[model samples]
Target: MKQQIPLYLGIDGGGTKCKARLEDAQGNLLGEGLAGPANPVRGLALSQQAVLDSTLMALEQAKLGQGQLPSVNACLGLAGVNVALYANQYKNWRHPFAKLHVMSDLQAACLGAHGNQDGAVIICGTGFNAGAYINGQLTEVGGHGFELGDHASGARLGINAVRRVLEAIDGLCQHSSMTKAITSYTKCSNASALFETYHKATPSQFAALAPIVIQYAKQGDVHAVEIMRTCAAYIDLVVERLQKLCPPRFSMIGGIAEPMFQWLNKASQDALVDPLHSPEEGAILFARNNEH
Candidate 1:
């Protein structure tokens, strides 16, 4: 009689963190791990390191050594994998496990939400992006990046709120509590300091200020509240665009998903569906289904 070889591993690489799951061939999830962002767009070395770190963590947790891991296949659904900026890194990843497959972070989100079924996903977290699955094709709706896009993401929230505060200080906009909140969050003493801080600081750190905006918005601060409202509008725009493009079933993902949900238009909210699983689970599902 022939013996069955083992297969396992699923990874969800995000902007905030990476999640790795170790499952048996029979589909029993055995171990899991968490680590920093694996978005290749963030940096090649950073992204690869994130994935490697998180995957190793999971294996260690699962009590599976490298020899055991090598027997298991892996599928990495990584954020920013679709972007061409990190193309060089995408071609090469350090993984002892075989049967490796690379896909965009949003691809796993869509699959996780619908179990490889046709669907769309609206993700709002540190960054905002939307993707669709139609007839096995990956079609992205938003996700233009943090500069002028990512309008509905946490990074966008921080950038927009701070900019509003800066504008208000110049008397171009009305005074707002957000001005103080922004200053406090970044630990900038004054306007000049804030400008200097921006040039020296990373966008990821500024994006971390999103929680402050969320807090103020909940407290009814007008500018802060506007940030949330505006965020919803941008996400809704993507949903509407995806609807026109594919009109498939859509689900939500990410940390700020609930906030986006709360502020979405009633019609948009009505169209939402519950996610069947997360990107991590979807990556596992991929590994399980595709036997090496």
Candidate 2:
């Protein structure tokens, strides 16, 4: 009798986007996919659809059919999975796969960064989140969502940048390079107009401005520097807390990580490490070890 080929699926689901990767037993990459936001905290229905859509895209790229899903061991690392309410609700939630593992995106990043070894990861992306893996325990901080927390996240940085620009216009704070950059980016005549236009902007839209802030900071813009510094401080706090729980091997992950890391203190920089693999690989690692 011939042995069947083994396959695995790994998913990194976040507030901004969902990513999926398919690989054979030997860990050679087969295919990958991307979809919309998959943060369950925002809406479980949307999250479920995003996950399914991205996974199917990967399977299609791998020239596999839906029937193959039941045979493929899968792991999903999702944002908002750290919330007890969401985690509890989704733990027993139905999925298409025969075997599946679910964890927070931060946890997946940690596993990916350290390759299942003891370490920590701070995700400073569209949303902020941190996690540490020590021995067998996984602990997380932040990532409560924009309205609640996510202090060091891209969304937050953008929001702060906008606020500073508005203050600058009102003569409440120093007007610097960010004022012009933010005004141009928002395409608003003035700070008040920007505020009005962005009163209901989406997370992705707000996060879009973070790069502008970082750019100005790179040019020695006073307001931009302060904003970046503030973000760095928030990240530093999370790293400090995680280090207290786990080894100091920290990897900064996500869109804003590099810019933010540049502002961290020397001690924090000393503890920094590079990730061994992507979060998708971490999901594969989880699937390999946890498949039923």
Candidate 3:
């Protein structure tokens, strides 16, 4: 009887979505899957379900069955795992994979962006975080979660936009096209309606409004531009701090990274390089390098 070749799974699980990639032992791509939000900080049960859902989808796409799960090795780069409590809780999950390795999404992104070489990465997505790997040491900054930090993140931008819109509606501030755009997007004609719409909004739900802010900023709306400038300033600070680590390369990623680039200072703009791979691929490299 011949032995079966090993299968590997790489997962990049973030506040907005979870992505999975399946590869053969020789590093050939097999299948991929995407699922909903998987940040444990938001909800541990939801995160776990997302991971499993994406993995099963990948398995099906790879023409494999659930029975093959025990033959697969998986590495998960997950958002919110930087918190010790969430990290330990995820590490103890009764997962279906043959072996599981877990790490923060920022670490996996840096590895992927720099091809597992020494580098730094700033993720400006639904949440914000920066990480650098240099000389076998990993340095991380920000990512304190939505309630506490996540400066320059989409959630922050969205919340700021909403605040501006509300102030404009209430006659507390001058209204602009940006505020009008936000009210239109939210279908809210008054402060009371807007408040009802977002009083219990999740980070991802807030992030959904960010594109409107970016669009208005691009159109030269005063309030939108001011918001974007603030966002850029925070990102600039993050870059300055990470550059002190002196990584050979640096990359900015996530949904807002490109749009926010124009608003960044020249120094921060010049410091960035294009990423070589996706975070999911970074998870694969991590799994391979750490496989026992």
Candidate 4:
């Protein structure tokens, strides 16, 4: 029988979604797939299922079947794995791939952004995190999770907007168009209603309100402007911290990266460059380098 060609899979799993890229040993792209959230911090079972679902989708797109899974090497860059507990949990999963390597999504983004060269990346989506690669060492900052940190994140923006709306409804603060808009969006005209609606909301649910805040800020609403400015200031500080590493390249990525760019300080703005590749591609690089 002819020897089957080696296959590689790169998985980028985050709070919102999981993406997979399939490639042959020669670096030729074969297929790609996307699925729902795979952040193990939220739920290890859900994350594992998402990983398998996305990988299967990629395999199907490549004209392969489940049997081929045993021939594939995979590198998974996942959110929440930065924590030792979550990392250990994921490493212990009985996955089907021939080989599996797990790493933090921030590290994967940095690798992808610089095409494996030394660089840095800041991710600003439902959550926030920053990582830098310098002189073969990988250093990370922030990403403590929603409750403790995640400064300048979409979830933070949403939470602040809701708080402001509640304050306005209670007459503690003057209402602006932004506040009114938020109340309307939540369908909560009174403070009690607002509290009930979001009291048990998840990070993604809160993050859903981020666009409303950005829109109202663009329209010059005082509350919105203040919220955006505060978030921007936090990002500025993160940039300053990362700058100490002096990475050869720096990039900001995630759902809010572009929308929030104008609000950032000039120094933070000047530090960014376009990423050379997507995080999934970076995962592929990792799989290739680490394959035994």
- Candidate 1 residue spans exceeding 4 A from truth: 1-5, 85-88, 245-248
Candidate 4 residue pairs in backbone clash? none
- Each prediction's total of clashing residue pairs, residues at least 3 apart in sequence or on different chains, is 0, 0, 0, 0
Q: Quick one: best lDDT, which candidate?
A: 3
lDDT of 4 by residue, 49-152 (tens): 99999999998888888789898999998989999999999878898989999999998898899999999999998888998989888888888988898888
Better of 2 and 3 by TM-score: 3
**Least accurate stretch of 10 residues (summed lDDT) in model 2?**
1-10
For all candidates in order, the CA lDDT equals: 0.77, 0.85, 0.91, 0.90
lDDT of 1 by residue, 11-104 (tens): 8887778888877767776778898878777787887788778877877877766566567688888877677666446777665667787878
Q: What would the TM-score be for candidate 4 when compared with the true structure? A: 0.95
Off by over 4 Å in 4: 1-4
Clash pairs of candidate 2? Answer: none
Best by TM-score: 3
* Structural similarity to truth (TM-score) of each candidate: 0.91, 0.92, 0.97, 0.95
Model 1: per-residue Cα lDDT at residue 72: 67
Q: Candidate 2 regions off by >4 Å? A: 1-5, 246-248
Q: Give the TM-score of candidate 3.
A: 0.97
Lowest summed-lDDT stretch of 10 residues in model 1? 1-10
Model 1 steric clash total: 0
